[model samples]
Target: MAEISAVSEGPRTEGDDYRGIMRFAHLVRADLPEPALAVLDGSQAILVSTLYPDAPATLQELIAGGSAALDAVRAAIADGAAVVHELTDFTFASAVLAPPAVLAVGLNYAAHSSELGLKTDAAPTVFTLWPNSLTGHGQTTSWPRSLSESVDYEAELGVLIGTAAKDVSEEDALDHVWGYTVVNDITARDIQFAEAQWSRCKSFDGFTPTGPVVVTADEIADPQDLHIWTNVDGHMVQDASTNQMVRSVRTLIAHLSQSLTLLPGTLISTGSPGGAGYSRDPQIFLRDRSTVTVGIDGIGELTTHCRILG
Candidate 1:
Protein backbone atom coordinates (compact mmCIF):
# COMPACT_ATOMS: atom_id res chain seq x y z
CA MET A 1 0.00 0.00 0.00
CA ALA A 2 1.11 3.54 -0.72
CA GLU A 3 2.09 5.65 2.28
CA ILE A 4 -0.15 8.63 2.95
CA SER A 5 1.09 11.90 4.40
CA ALA A 6 -1.24 14.38 6.00
CA VAL A 7 -2.39 17.04 3.53
CA SER A 8 -2.14 19.89 6.02
CA GLU A 9 0.87 22.09 5.22
CA GLY A 10 1.53 24.87 7.67
CA PRO A 11 3.69 25.76 10.62
CA ARG A 12 3.87 22.80 13.05
CA THR A 13 3.25 23.14 16.77
CA GLU A 14 4.21 20.97 19.75
CA GLY A 15 1.10 18.93 20.71
CA ASP A 16 0.73 19.81 24.40
CA ASP A 17 -2.88 21.00 24.65
CA TYR A 18 -4.66 17.80 23.61
CA ARG A 19 -4.92 15.18 26.33
CA GLY A 20 -7.38 12.31 26.06
CA ILE A 21 -7.77 8.73 24.81
CA MET A 22 -5.90 7.85 21.62
CA ARG A 23 -7.24 5.49 18.90
CA PHE A 24 -6.15 5.26 15.27
CA ALA A 25 -7.56 4.82 11.74
CA HIS A 26 -6.91 5.67 8.12
CA LEU A 27 -9.33 8.39 7.02
CA VAL A 28 -10.38 9.99 3.75
CA ARG A 29 -12.11 13.33 3.55
CA ALA A 30 -13.62 15.11 0.56
CA ASP A 31 -10.80 17.66 0.65
CA LEU A 32 -7.98 15.15 0.87
CA PRO A 33 -6.79 13.23 -2.19
CA GLU A 34 -5.77 10.13 -0.22
CA PRO A 35 -6.36 8.42 3.07
CA ALA A 36 -4.05 9.52 5.91
CA LEU A 37 -3.14 8.06 9.28
CA ALA A 38 -5.28 9.77 11.93
CA VAL A 39 -5.08 9.71 15.69
CA LEU A 40 -8.61 9.66 17.01
CA ASP A 41 -9.53 11.40 20.25
CA GLY A 42 -13.20 10.70 20.74
CA SER A 43 -15.05 12.39 17.86
CA GLN A 44 -11.96 14.32 16.76
CA ALA A 45 -9.07 13.24 14.53
CA ILE A 46 -5.49 14.48 14.65
CA LEU A 47 -3.38 14.02 11.57
CA VAL A 48 -0.30 12.01 12.56
CA SER A 49 2.05 13.10 9.79
CA THR A 50 1.31 16.71 10.64
CA LEU A 51 2.56 16.14 14.19
CA TYR A 52 6.01 15.45 12.76
CA PRO A 53 7.34 15.49 9.21
CA ASP A 54 9.00 12.11 9.76
CA ALA A 55 5.98 10.45 11.38
CA PRO A 56 5.04 7.04 10.05
CA ALA A 57 2.55 7.30 7.18
CA THR A 58 0.82 3.98 7.70
CA LEU A 59 -0.12 1.64 10.56
CA GLN A 60 2.49 -0.84 9.31
CA GLU A 61 5.22 1.79 9.55
CA LEU A 62 4.01 2.82 12.99
CA ILE A 63 4.07 -0.81 14.20
CA ALA A 64 7.52 -1.28 12.68
CA GLY A 65 8.65 1.73 14.73
CA GLY A 66 7.94 -0.21 17.95
CA SER A 67 7.35 1.24 21.43
CA ALA A 68 9.63 4.26 21.05
CA ALA A 69 7.68 5.56 18.07
CA LEU A 70 4.38 4.93 19.79
CA ASP A 71 5.67 6.82 22.82
CA ALA A 72 6.69 9.70 20.57
CA VAL A 73 3.20 9.74 19.06
CA ARG A 74 1.57 9.78 22.48
CA ALA A 75 3.99 12.50 23.53
CA ALA A 76 3.19 14.50 20.44
CA ILE A 77 -0.53 14.18 21.12
CA ALA A 78 0.02 15.23 24.72
CA ASP A 79 1.94 18.20 23.37
CA GLY A 80 -1.03 19.17 21.13
CA ALA A 81 0.95 19.27 17.87
CA ALA A 82 -1.35 18.34 14.98
CA VAL A 83 -4.38 19.77 13.21
CA VAL A 84 -7.54 18.31 14.69
CA HIS A 85 -10.74 17.64 12.72
CA GLU A 86 -14.07 16.20 13.71
CA LEU A 87 -14.12 12.52 12.80
CA THR A 88 -17.58 12.93 11.28
CA ASP A 89 -16.08 15.07 8.56
CA PHE A 90 -13.96 12.23 7.28
CA THR A 91 -14.82 8.73 5.97
CA PHE A 92 -12.98 5.73 7.42
CA ALA A 93 -10.61 3.59 5.40
CA SER A 94 -9.66 0.05 6.48
CA ALA A 95 -8.22 0.18 10.02
CA VAL A 96 -5.39 -1.95 8.73
CA LEU A 97 -4.52 -0.42 5.41
CA ALA A 98 -1.61 -2.69 4.54
CA PRO A 99 -0.97 -5.58 6.87
CA PRO A 100 1.88 -7.91 5.94
CA ALA A 101 -0.67 -10.73 6.00
CA VAL A 102 -4.32 -11.35 6.85
CA LEU A 103 -4.61 -14.71 8.57
CA ALA A 104 -7.95 -16.18 9.60
CA VAL A 105 -8.82 -18.99 12.01
CA GLY A 106 -11.76 -21.29 11.39
CA LEU A 107 -13.92 -23.51 13.66
CA ASN A 108 -12.28 -22.09 16.75
CA TYR A 109 -15.69 -22.07 18.35
CA ALA A 110 -17.18 -25.50 18.98
CA ALA A 111 -20.69 -24.12 18.70
CA HIS A 112 -19.90 -22.77 15.26
CA SER A 113 -18.34 -26.05 14.20
CA SER A 114 -21.34 -28.02 15.42
CA GLU A 115 -23.85 -25.66 13.85
CA LEU A 116 -22.17 -25.95 10.48
CA GLY A 117 -21.79 -29.72 10.89
CA LEU A 118 -18.02 -29.34 10.59
CA LYS A 119 -15.63 -30.75 13.13
CA THR A 120 -13.08 -28.61 14.92
CA ASP A 121 -9.65 -29.69 13.83
CA ALA A 122 -7.01 -30.83 16.36
CA ALA A 123 -5.31 -27.56 15.38
CA PRO A 124 -6.83 -24.28 14.24
CA THR A 125 -8.18 -24.24 10.68
CA VAL A 126 -6.11 -21.39 9.29
CA PHE A 127 -6.59 -19.58 6.00
CA THR A 128 -5.43 -16.45 4.18
CA LEU A 129 -7.65 -13.63 2.92
CA TRP A 130 -6.43 -11.80 -0.14
CA PRO A 131 -5.92 -8.05 0.17
CA ASN A 132 -8.43 -7.20 -2.56
CA SER A 133 -11.24 -8.44 -0.30
CA LEU A 134 -10.48 -5.76 2.26
CA THR A 135 -12.92 -2.85 2.45
CA GLY A 136 -13.51 -0.13 5.01
CA HIS A 137 -16.45 0.50 7.29
CA GLY A 138 -19.57 1.86 5.56
CA GLN A 139 -18.20 0.76 2.17
CA THR A 140 -20.13 -1.44 -0.25
CA THR A 141 -19.11 -5.05 -0.99
CA SER A 142 -20.56 -6.48 -4.19
CA TRP A 143 -20.57 -10.00 -5.59
CA PRO A 144 -22.25 -11.69 -8.52
CA ARG A 145 -25.34 -13.88 -8.26
CA SER A 146 -23.46 -16.18 -10.61
CA LEU A 147 -20.92 -16.74 -7.87
CA SER A 148 -23.35 -18.24 -5.35
CA GLU A 149 -26.49 -17.29 -3.48
CA SER A 150 -25.53 -18.61 -0.06
CA VAL A 151 -23.25 -15.86 1.20
CA ASP A 152 -22.77 -15.66 4.97
CA TYR A 153 -21.26 -13.39 7.60
CA GLU A 154 -18.77 -14.20 10.33
CA ALA A 155 -18.20 -11.65 13.08
CA GLU A 156 -14.70 -12.04 14.46
CA LEU A 157 -12.16 -10.42 16.77
CA GLY A 158 -9.15 -9.20 14.81
CA VAL A 159 -5.72 -9.18 16.46
CA LEU A 160 -3.01 -6.88 15.21
CA ILE A 161 0.61 -7.93 15.88
CA GLY A 162 3.07 -5.35 17.15
CA THR A 163 6.31 -7.31 17.15
CA ALA A 164 7.83 -10.12 15.08
CA ALA A 165 6.95 -13.33 16.87
CA LYS A 166 8.46 -16.76 16.18
CA ASP A 167 8.16 -19.82 18.41
CA VAL A 168 6.66 -17.73 21.22
CA SER A 169 5.07 -19.15 24.32
CA GLU A 170 1.37 -18.63 25.07
CA GLU A 171 2.31 -16.62 28.16
CA ASP A 172 4.31 -14.20 26.00
CA ALA A 173 1.94 -14.18 23.03
CA LEU A 174 -0.18 -11.22 24.00
CA ASP A 175 3.01 -9.22 24.45
CA HIS A 176 3.41 -9.16 20.68
CA VAL A 177 -0.04 -7.68 20.12
CA TRP A 178 -0.26 -4.10 18.93
CA GLY A 179 -4.04 -3.82 19.22
CA TYR A 180 -7.45 -5.24 18.25
CA THR A 181 -10.22 -4.49 15.76
CA VAL A 182 -13.47 -6.04 14.48
CA VAL A 183 -13.62 -8.02 11.24
CA ASN A 184 -16.57 -9.27 9.19
CA ASP A 185 -15.21 -12.41 7.50
CA ILE A 186 -17.87 -12.58 4.79
CA THR A 187 -18.07 -15.90 2.96
CA ALA A 188 -19.77 -17.68 0.06
CA ARG A 189 -21.04 -20.95 1.51
CA ASP A 190 -21.59 -22.77 -1.81
CA ILE A 191 -18.14 -22.01 -3.12
CA GLN A 192 -16.58 -22.85 0.24
CA PHE A 193 -18.19 -26.32 0.16
CA ALA A 194 -17.22 -26.88 -3.44
CA GLU A 195 -13.53 -26.07 -2.98
CA ALA A 196 -11.04 -27.86 -0.78
CA GLN A 197 -9.02 -24.71 -0.15
CA TRP A 198 -10.89 -21.74 1.40
CA SER A 199 -8.89 -18.70 0.33
CA ARG A 200 -10.69 -17.99 -2.92
CA CYS A 201 -14.19 -18.68 -1.67
CA LYS A 202 -13.73 -16.25 1.19
CA SER A 203 -11.44 -13.89 -0.70
CA PHE A 204 -13.89 -12.56 -3.25
CA ASP A 205 -13.44 -8.82 -3.75
CA GLY A 206 -14.78 -6.82 -0.80
CA PHE A 207 -15.40 -9.97 1.26
CA THR A 208 -13.62 -8.60 4.30
CA PRO A 209 -14.90 -5.36 5.80
CA THR A 210 -12.49 -4.43 8.58
CA GLY A 211 -12.83 -1.33 10.68
CA PRO A 212 -14.43 1.75 11.87
CA VAL A 213 -11.40 1.98 14.20
CA VAL A 214 -8.65 -0.05 15.91
CA VAL A 215 -8.15 0.30 19.67
CA THR A 216 -4.67 -0.15 21.13
CA ALA A 217 -4.01 -3.34 23.12
CA ASP A 218 -3.66 -1.40 26.36
CA GLU A 219 -7.31 -0.42 26.03
CA ILE A 220 -8.56 -3.99 26.20
CA ALA A 221 -8.28 -5.86 29.52
CA ASP A 222 -8.87 -9.36 28.20
CA PRO A 223 -9.32 -10.25 24.54
CA GLN A 224 -11.36 -13.30 25.50
CA ASP A 225 -13.73 -11.39 27.77
CA LEU A 226 -15.14 -9.05 25.17
CA HIS A 227 -18.71 -9.21 23.77
CA ILE A 228 -18.91 -9.92 20.04
CA TRP A 229 -22.06 -9.70 17.95
CA THR A 230 -23.48 -9.26 14.47
CA ASN A 231 -26.44 -7.15 13.45
CA VAL A 232 -27.83 -7.81 10.01
CA ASP A 233 -29.79 -4.72 9.04
CA GLY A 234 -31.83 -4.44 12.26
CA HIS A 235 -31.84 -8.02 13.50
CA MET A 236 -29.29 -9.31 16.00
CA VAL A 237 -28.30 -12.49 14.20
CA GLN A 238 -25.12 -13.60 15.89
CA ASP A 239 -24.71 -12.72 19.57
CA ALA A 240 -21.93 -14.28 21.59
CA SER A 241 -18.81 -13.58 23.68
CA THR A 242 -15.16 -14.07 22.85
CA ASN A 243 -14.92 -16.24 25.96
CA GLN A 244 -16.61 -19.03 24.04
CA MET A 245 -13.70 -19.54 21.67
CA VAL A 246 -12.40 -23.12 21.51
CA ARG A 247 -8.90 -21.66 21.61
CA SER A 248 -7.78 -18.43 23.19
CA VAL A 249 -6.16 -15.63 21.20
CA ARG A 250 -2.85 -16.19 22.96
CA THR A 251 -2.88 -19.91 22.11
CA LEU A 252 -3.63 -19.20 18.45
CA ILE A 253 -0.77 -16.71 18.26
CA ALA A 254 1.64 -19.05 19.98
CA HIS A 255 0.73 -21.90 17.63
CA LEU A 256 1.05 -19.71 14.53
CA SER A 257 4.40 -18.27 15.62
CA GLN A 258 5.97 -21.73 16.00
CA SER A 259 5.71 -22.32 12.25
CA LEU A 260 6.57 -18.84 10.95
CA THR A 261 7.45 -15.35 12.05
CA LEU A 262 4.30 -13.24 12.39
CA LEU A 263 5.58 -9.80 11.45
CA PRO A 264 4.43 -6.49 12.82
CA GLY A 265 1.15 -5.28 11.27
CA THR A 266 -0.06 -8.83 10.71
CA LEU A 267 -3.82 -9.26 11.36
CA ILE A 268 -5.02 -12.53 12.81
CA SER A 269 -8.82 -12.74 12.66
CA THR A 270 -9.68 -15.15 15.41
CA GLY A 271 -12.65 -17.23 14.21
CA SER A 272 -16.29 -16.26 14.64
CA PRO A 273 -18.64 -17.77 17.15
CA GLY A 274 -21.87 -19.73 16.69
CA GLY A 275 -25.16 -18.42 15.20
CA ALA A 276 -24.00 -18.04 11.61
CA GLY A 277 -26.70 -17.54 8.97
CA TYR A 278 -25.65 -20.75 7.23
CA SER A 279 -26.74 -22.70 10.30
CA ARG A 280 -30.00 -20.86 10.87
CA ASP A 281 -33.16 -23.00 10.96
CA PRO A 282 -34.46 -21.37 7.77
CA GLN A 283 -31.09 -19.98 6.66
CA ILE A 284 -30.19 -16.26 6.50
CA PHE A 285 -27.84 -15.51 3.66
CA LEU A 286 -26.76 -11.96 2.83
CA ARG A 287 -29.08 -10.81 0.06
CA ASP A 288 -28.56 -7.93 -2.30
CA ARG A 289 -28.65 -4.52 -0.63
CA SER A 290 -28.20 -6.09 2.79
CA THR A 291 -26.20 -4.23 5.45
CA VAL A 292 -24.25 -6.20 8.02
CA THR A 293 -22.55 -4.70 11.06
CA VAL A 294 -20.19 -6.76 13.20
CA GLY A 295 -18.82 -5.43 16.47
CA ILE A 296 -16.59 -6.41 19.38
CA ASP A 297 -16.78 -4.40 22.60
CA GLY A 298 -13.70 -2.26 23.33
CA ILE A 299 -12.82 -2.53 19.69
CA GLY A 300 -15.15 -0.85 17.16
CA GLU A 301 -18.04 -1.90 14.92
CA LEU A 302 -17.47 -2.63 11.23
CA THR A 303 -20.32 -2.40 8.69
CA THR A 304 -20.44 -3.61 5.12
CA HIS A 305 -23.13 -2.90 2.52
CA CYS A 306 -23.67 -5.69 0.02
CA ARG A 307 -24.81 -5.85 -3.61
CA ILE A 308 -25.47 -8.98 -5.62
CA LEU A 309 -25.09 -8.51 -9.35
CA GLY A 310 -27.28 -10.62 -11.63
Candidate 2:
Protein backbone atom coordinates (compact mmCIF):
# COMPACT_ATOMS: atom_id res chain seq x y z
CA MET A 1 0.00 0.00 0.00
CA ALA A 2 1.40 3.35 -1.07
CA GLU A 3 0.68 6.75 0.40
CA ILE A 4 -2.67 7.99 -0.81
CA SER A 5 -1.80 11.66 -0.34
CA ALA A 6 0.92 13.12 -2.53
CA VAL A 7 1.78 16.82 -2.81
CA SER A 8 3.09 18.01 -6.15
CA GLU A 9 6.56 19.58 -5.99
CA GLY A 10 7.11 20.23 -9.67
CA PRO A 11 6.42 23.23 -11.87
CA ARG A 12 3.54 25.14 -10.29
CA THR A 13 0.42 26.41 -12.01
CA GLU A 14 1.37 29.88 -13.24
CA GLY A 15 -2.02 31.44 -12.54
CA ASP A 16 -4.65 30.87 -9.89
CA ASP A 17 -7.26 31.65 -12.56
CA TYR A 18 -6.53 28.88 -15.06
CA ARG A 19 -10.32 28.16 -15.03
CA GLY A 20 -12.22 24.85 -15.08
CA ILE A 21 -11.41 21.42 -13.75
CA MET A 22 -9.01 19.51 -16.03
CA ARG A 23 -11.23 17.35 -18.23
CA PHE A 24 -9.03 14.46 -19.38
CA ALA A 25 -9.59 12.15 -22.34
CA HIS A 26 -7.90 10.24 -25.12
CA LEU A 27 -8.01 12.03 -28.49
CA VAL A 28 -7.37 10.32 -31.82
CA ARG A 29 -6.04 12.08 -34.91
CA ALA A 30 -6.11 10.63 -38.41
CA ASP A 31 -2.36 10.65 -38.71
CA LEU A 32 -1.93 9.12 -35.28
CA PRO A 33 -3.67 5.76 -35.31
CA GLU A 34 -3.42 5.45 -31.54
CA PRO A 35 -5.20 7.77 -29.11
CA ALA A 36 -3.21 10.30 -27.08
CA LEU A 37 -4.00 11.77 -23.70
CA ALA A 38 -5.32 15.35 -23.82
CA VAL A 39 -6.93 17.97 -21.68
CA LEU A 40 -10.18 19.39 -23.05
CA ASP A 41 -9.70 23.15 -23.21
CA GLY A 42 -12.82 24.97 -24.40
CA SER A 43 -12.62 24.56 -28.18
CA GLN A 44 -9.12 23.11 -28.10
CA ALA A 45 -7.28 20.11 -26.73
CA ILE A 46 -3.92 20.41 -25.02
CA LEU A 47 -1.99 17.27 -25.76
CA VAL A 48 -0.70 15.88 -22.49
CA SER A 49 2.27 14.34 -24.26
CA THR A 50 3.30 17.79 -25.46
CA LEU A 51 2.63 19.32 -22.06
CA TYR A 52 6.00 18.23 -20.70
CA PRO A 53 8.72 15.81 -21.65
CA ASP A 54 7.67 13.37 -18.93
CA ALA A 55 3.90 13.74 -19.01
CA PRO A 56 1.82 10.59 -18.67
CA ALA A 57 0.59 9.10 -21.95
CA THR A 58 -2.75 7.78 -20.64
CA LEU A 59 -5.16 8.06 -17.73
CA GLN A 60 -3.71 4.95 -16.10
CA GLU A 61 -0.23 6.43 -16.27
CA LEU A 62 -1.47 9.69 -14.83
CA ILE A 63 -3.17 7.85 -11.98
CA ALA A 64 -0.04 5.83 -11.34
CA GLY A 65 2.02 9.03 -11.41
CA GLY A 66 -0.25 10.42 -8.71
CA SER A 67 -0.72 14.12 -7.89
CA ALA A 68 2.79 15.04 -8.99
CA ALA A 69 2.18 14.19 -12.62
CA LEU A 70 -1.29 15.76 -12.58
CA ASP A 71 0.04 18.99 -11.07
CA ALA A 72 2.82 19.09 -13.64
CA VAL A 73 0.30 18.81 -16.48
CA ARG A 74 -1.85 21.48 -14.89
CA ALA A 75 1.17 23.74 -14.53
CA ALA A 76 2.13 23.20 -18.17
CA ILE A 77 -1.42 23.96 -19.32
CA ALA A 78 -1.62 27.17 -17.28
CA ASP A 79 1.92 28.16 -18.24
CA GLY A 80 0.83 27.98 -21.88
CA ALA A 81 3.97 26.25 -23.02
CA ALA A 82 2.39 23.28 -24.82
CA VAL A 83 0.90 23.22 -28.34
CA VAL A 84 -2.83 22.71 -28.68
CA HIS A 85 -5.14 21.58 -31.47
CA GLU A 86 -8.75 22.32 -32.32
CA LEU A 87 -11.10 20.16 -30.31
CA THR A 88 -13.08 19.29 -33.43
CA ASP A 89 -9.98 18.19 -35.33
CA PHE A 90 -9.60 15.08 -33.21
CA THR A 91 -12.08 12.32 -32.29
CA PHE A 92 -12.65 11.16 -28.70
CA ALA A 93 -11.50 7.89 -27.11
CA SER A 94 -12.52 6.13 -23.95
CA ALA A 95 -11.44 8.26 -20.96
CA VAL A 96 -10.24 4.99 -19.54
CA LEU A 97 -8.42 2.95 -22.14
CA ALA A 98 -7.18 0.16 -19.89
CA PRO A 99 -7.62 -0.50 -16.21
CA PRO A 100 -6.70 -3.06 -13.61
CA ALA A 101 -10.32 -4.20 -13.68
CA VAL A 102 -13.76 -3.05 -14.82
CA LEU A 103 -16.27 -3.81 -12.08
CA ALA A 104 -19.98 -3.18 -12.46
CA VAL A 105 -23.01 -3.19 -10.22
CA GLY A 106 -26.29 -4.73 -11.26
CA LEU A 107 -29.88 -4.16 -10.10
CA ASN A 108 -28.60 -1.28 -8.01
CA TYR A 109 -31.65 0.73 -8.92
CA ALA A 110 -35.02 -0.44 -7.62
CA ALA A 111 -36.85 0.54 -10.76
CA HIS A 112 -34.37 -1.29 -12.98
CA SER A 113 -34.60 -4.42 -10.83
CA SER A 114 -38.39 -4.31 -10.73
CA GLU A 115 -38.69 -3.79 -14.48
CA LEU A 116 -36.10 -6.43 -15.36
CA GLY A 117 -37.76 -8.97 -13.06
CA LEU A 118 -34.63 -9.40 -10.93
CA LYS A 119 -34.10 -9.03 -7.22
CA THR A 120 -31.79 -6.41 -5.81
CA ASP A 121 -29.77 -8.31 -3.25
CA ALA A 122 -29.35 -6.98 0.28
CA ALA A 123 -25.73 -6.54 -0.77
CA PRO A 124 -24.76 -5.04 -4.12
CA THR A 125 -24.69 -7.29 -7.20
CA VAL A 126 -21.21 -6.81 -8.61
CA PHE A 127 -19.65 -8.26 -11.75
CA THR A 128 -16.57 -7.87 -13.93
CA LEU A 129 -16.46 -6.42 -17.46
CA TRP A 130 -13.94 -7.38 -20.09
CA PRO A 131 -11.57 -4.86 -21.62
CA ASN A 132 -12.65 -5.82 -25.15
CA SER A 133 -16.12 -4.41 -24.46
CA LEU A 134 -14.77 -0.93 -23.78
CA THR A 135 -15.16 1.69 -26.50
CA GLY A 136 -15.21 5.45 -26.74
CA HIS A 137 -17.98 7.95 -27.27
CA GLY A 138 -19.22 8.50 -30.83
CA GLN A 139 -17.98 5.06 -31.88
CA THR A 140 -20.09 2.40 -33.59
CA THR A 141 -20.95 -0.87 -31.78
CA SER A 142 -22.13 -3.73 -33.93
CA TRP A 143 -23.43 -7.21 -33.15
CA PRO A 144 -24.64 -10.15 -35.18
CA ARG A 145 -28.41 -10.46 -35.07
CA SER A 146 -27.92 -14.21 -35.17
CA LEU A 147 -26.00 -14.09 -31.89
CA SER A 148 -28.70 -12.17 -30.01
CA GLU A 149 -31.29 -9.71 -31.32
CA SER A 150 -32.40 -8.38 -27.95
CA VAL A 151 -29.60 -5.92 -27.15
CA ASP A 152 -30.48 -3.28 -24.53
CA TYR A 153 -29.08 -0.04 -23.19
CA GLU A 154 -28.29 1.01 -19.66
CA ALA A 155 -27.11 4.44 -18.50
CA GLU A 156 -24.57 4.25 -15.73
CA LEU A 157 -22.11 6.38 -13.77
CA GLY A 158 -18.49 5.22 -14.01
CA VAL A 159 -16.07 5.68 -11.12
CA LEU A 160 -12.31 5.46 -11.50
CA ILE A 161 -10.14 4.58 -8.52
CA GLY A 162 -7.01 6.71 -8.08
CA THR A 163 -5.14 4.62 -5.51
CA ALA A 164 -5.03 1.11 -4.12
CA ALA A 165 -7.71 0.81 -1.48
CA LYS A 166 -8.51 -2.11 0.79
CA ASP A 167 -11.06 -2.49 3.55
CA VAL A 168 -11.84 1.18 3.41
CA SER A 169 -14.58 2.60 5.53
CA GLU A 170 -17.61 4.11 3.81
CA GLU A 171 -16.68 7.54 5.13
CA ASP A 172 -13.26 7.34 3.48
CA ALA A 173 -14.12 5.45 0.32
CA LEU A 174 -14.51 8.53 -1.84
CA ASP A 175 -10.96 9.62 -1.10
CA HIS A 176 -9.72 6.97 -3.50
CA VAL A 177 -11.78 8.18 -6.47
CA TRP A 178 -9.71 9.63 -9.30
CA GLY A 179 -12.53 10.86 -11.53
CA TYR A 180 -16.01 10.20 -12.88
CA THR A 181 -17.40 9.48 -16.34
CA VAL A 182 -20.46 8.09 -18.15
CA VAL A 183 -20.89 4.43 -19.13
CA ASN A 184 -23.61 2.80 -21.22
CA ASP A 185 -23.73 -0.79 -19.92
CA ILE A 186 -25.18 -2.25 -23.13
CA THR A 187 -26.51 -5.75 -22.63
CA ALA A 188 -27.83 -8.62 -24.73
CA ARG A 189 -31.17 -8.92 -22.90
CA ASP A 190 -32.11 -12.43 -23.97
CA ILE A 191 -28.62 -13.64 -23.22
CA GLN A 192 -28.58 -11.79 -19.92
CA PHE A 193 -31.61 -13.80 -18.77
CA ALA A 194 -30.58 -17.05 -20.40
CA GLU A 195 -27.09 -17.12 -18.89
CA ALA A 196 -26.39 -17.78 -15.23
CA GLN A 197 -23.76 -15.01 -15.23
CA TRP A 198 -24.09 -11.40 -16.37
CA SER A 199 -20.55 -10.65 -17.57
CA ARG A 200 -20.65 -12.69 -20.78
CA CYS A 201 -24.04 -11.35 -21.79
CA LYS A 202 -22.80 -7.77 -21.34
CA SER A 203 -19.14 -8.21 -22.25
CA PHE A 204 -19.46 -8.50 -26.02
CA ASP A 205 -16.93 -6.44 -27.95
CA GLY A 206 -17.77 -2.71 -27.85
CA PHE A 207 -20.72 -3.36 -25.55
CA THR A 208 -19.52 -0.93 -22.86
CA PRO A 209 -19.17 2.50 -24.42
CA THR A 210 -17.74 5.14 -22.10
CA GLY A 211 -16.21 8.56 -22.00
CA PRO A 212 -15.82 11.71 -24.03
CA VAL A 213 -14.21 13.00 -20.82
CA VAL A 214 -13.39 12.11 -17.25
CA VAL A 215 -14.14 14.95 -14.85
CA THR A 216 -11.78 14.94 -11.87
CA ALA A 217 -13.41 13.85 -8.60
CA ASP A 218 -13.18 17.36 -7.22
CA GLU A 219 -15.45 18.65 -10.00
CA ILE A 220 -18.31 16.43 -8.90
CA ALA A 221 -19.80 17.64 -5.61
CA ASP A 222 -21.85 14.55 -4.86
CA PRO A 223 -21.87 11.48 -7.08
CA GLN A 224 -25.23 10.42 -5.68
CA ASP A 225 -26.94 13.69 -6.61
CA LEU A 226 -26.30 13.95 -10.33
CA HIS A 227 -28.73 13.51 -13.23
CA ILE A 228 -28.27 10.28 -15.29
CA TRP A 229 -30.28 9.51 -18.41
CA THR A 230 -30.31 7.89 -21.85
CA ASN A 231 -31.71 8.43 -25.34
CA VAL A 232 -32.24 6.00 -28.20
CA ASP A 233 -32.14 7.19 -31.85
CA GLY A 234 -34.04 10.42 -31.04
CA HIS A 235 -36.37 9.67 -28.16
CA MET A 236 -35.61 9.86 -24.43
CA VAL A 237 -35.78 6.33 -23.09
CA GLN A 238 -34.29 6.29 -19.58
CA ASP A 239 -34.26 9.34 -17.33
CA ALA A 240 -33.39 9.25 -13.65
CA SER A 241 -31.04 10.49 -10.96
CA THR A 242 -28.04 8.82 -9.30
CA ASN A 243 -30.01 9.53 -6.15
CA GLN A 244 -32.17 6.57 -7.09
CA MET A 245 -29.30 4.09 -6.66
CA VAL A 246 -29.77 1.44 -3.98
CA ARG A 247 -26.17 1.87 -2.90
CA SER A 248 -24.25 5.13 -3.05
CA VAL A 249 -20.84 5.31 -4.70
CA ARG A 250 -19.11 5.47 -1.33
CA THR A 251 -21.01 2.47 -0.04
CA LEU A 252 -20.16 0.33 -3.05
CA ILE A 253 -16.48 1.24 -2.86
CA ALA A 254 -16.31 0.54 0.84
CA HIS A 255 -18.00 -2.81 0.49
CA LEU A 256 -15.91 -3.89 -2.47
CA SER A 257 -12.68 -2.74 -0.85
CA GLN A 258 -13.33 -5.01 2.09
CA SER A 259 -12.64 -8.03 -0.05
CA LEU A 260 -9.54 -6.92 -1.99
CA THR A 261 -7.47 -3.97 -2.99
CA LEU A 262 -9.02 -1.92 -5.79
CA LEU A 263 -5.88 -1.12 -7.73
CA PRO A 264 -5.14 2.24 -9.29
CA GLY A 265 -7.11 2.98 -12.49
CA THR A 266 -9.79 0.40 -11.75
CA LEU A 267 -13.27 1.37 -12.98
CA ILE A 268 -16.51 0.66 -11.13
CA SER A 269 -19.67 1.22 -13.16
CA THR A 270 -22.36 2.09 -10.57
CA GLY A 271 -25.24 0.49 -12.44
CA SER A 272 -28.25 1.84 -14.37
CA PRO A 273 -31.63 3.30 -13.66
CA GLY A 274 -35.03 2.15 -14.90
CA GLY A 275 -36.58 2.40 -18.39
CA ALA A 276 -34.59 -0.38 -20.05
CA GLY A 277 -35.85 -0.92 -23.60
CA TYR A 278 -36.67 -4.52 -22.65
CA SER A 279 -39.18 -3.46 -20.00
CA ARG A 280 -41.29 -1.09 -22.04
CA ASP A 281 -44.89 -1.62 -23.23
CA PRO A 282 -43.63 -2.40 -26.73
CA GLN A 283 -40.03 -3.37 -26.03
CA ILE A 284 -37.29 -1.73 -28.02
CA PHE A 285 -33.78 -2.85 -28.90
CA LEU A 286 -30.79 -1.28 -30.58
CA ARG A 287 -31.57 -1.95 -34.24
CA ASP A 288 -29.28 -1.44 -37.19
CA ARG A 289 -28.24 2.21 -37.57
CA SER A 290 -29.84 3.14 -34.28
CA THR A 291 -28.01 5.54 -31.95
CA VAL A 292 -27.98 5.85 -28.18
CA THR A 293 -26.65 8.53 -25.86
CA VAL A 294 -26.21 8.18 -22.12
CA GLY A 295 -25.23 11.21 -20.08
CA ILE A 296 -24.48 12.48 -16.61
CA ASP A 297 -25.08 16.15 -15.83
CA GLY A 298 -21.89 18.13 -15.04
CA ILE A 299 -19.79 15.33 -16.54
CA GLY A 300 -20.35 14.43 -20.22
CA GLU A 301 -22.55 12.60 -22.72
CA LEU A 302 -21.49 9.31 -24.42
CA THR A 303 -23.00 8.26 -27.74
CA THR A 304 -22.81 4.89 -29.47
CA HIS A 305 -24.13 4.07 -32.94
CA CYS A 306 -25.68 0.66 -33.37
CA ARG A 307 -25.25 -1.73 -36.33
CA ILE A 308 -26.83 -5.13 -36.47
CA LEU A 309 -25.26 -7.68 -38.80
CA GLY A 310 -26.97 -10.53 -40.58
lDDT of 1 by residue, 181-242 (tens): 89999999999999899999899998988877778898899999999999997999989999
TM-score each candidate. 0.93, 0.94
Residues 1-310 of candidate 2 have per-residue lDDT tens digits of: 0011222223323563456658898888778868899777445566788776878999999999998888888777777465656444567777799899999999999999999998999999999999999999888899999999999999999999998999999999999999999999999999988889999999999999888889899999999999999999899999999999999999999999999899999999999999999999899999999999999999988999999999
Minimum summed lDDT over a 10-residue window in model 2 is located at 1-10
After best superposition, candidate 1 residue 28: deviation in angstroms? 1.1
Q: Model 1, which residues run further than 4 Å from truth?
A: 1-20
Give the C-alpha lDDT of model 1: 0.87
Colliding pairs, model 2:
none
Candidate 2 residues lying further than 4 Å off, grouped into runs, are: 1-17
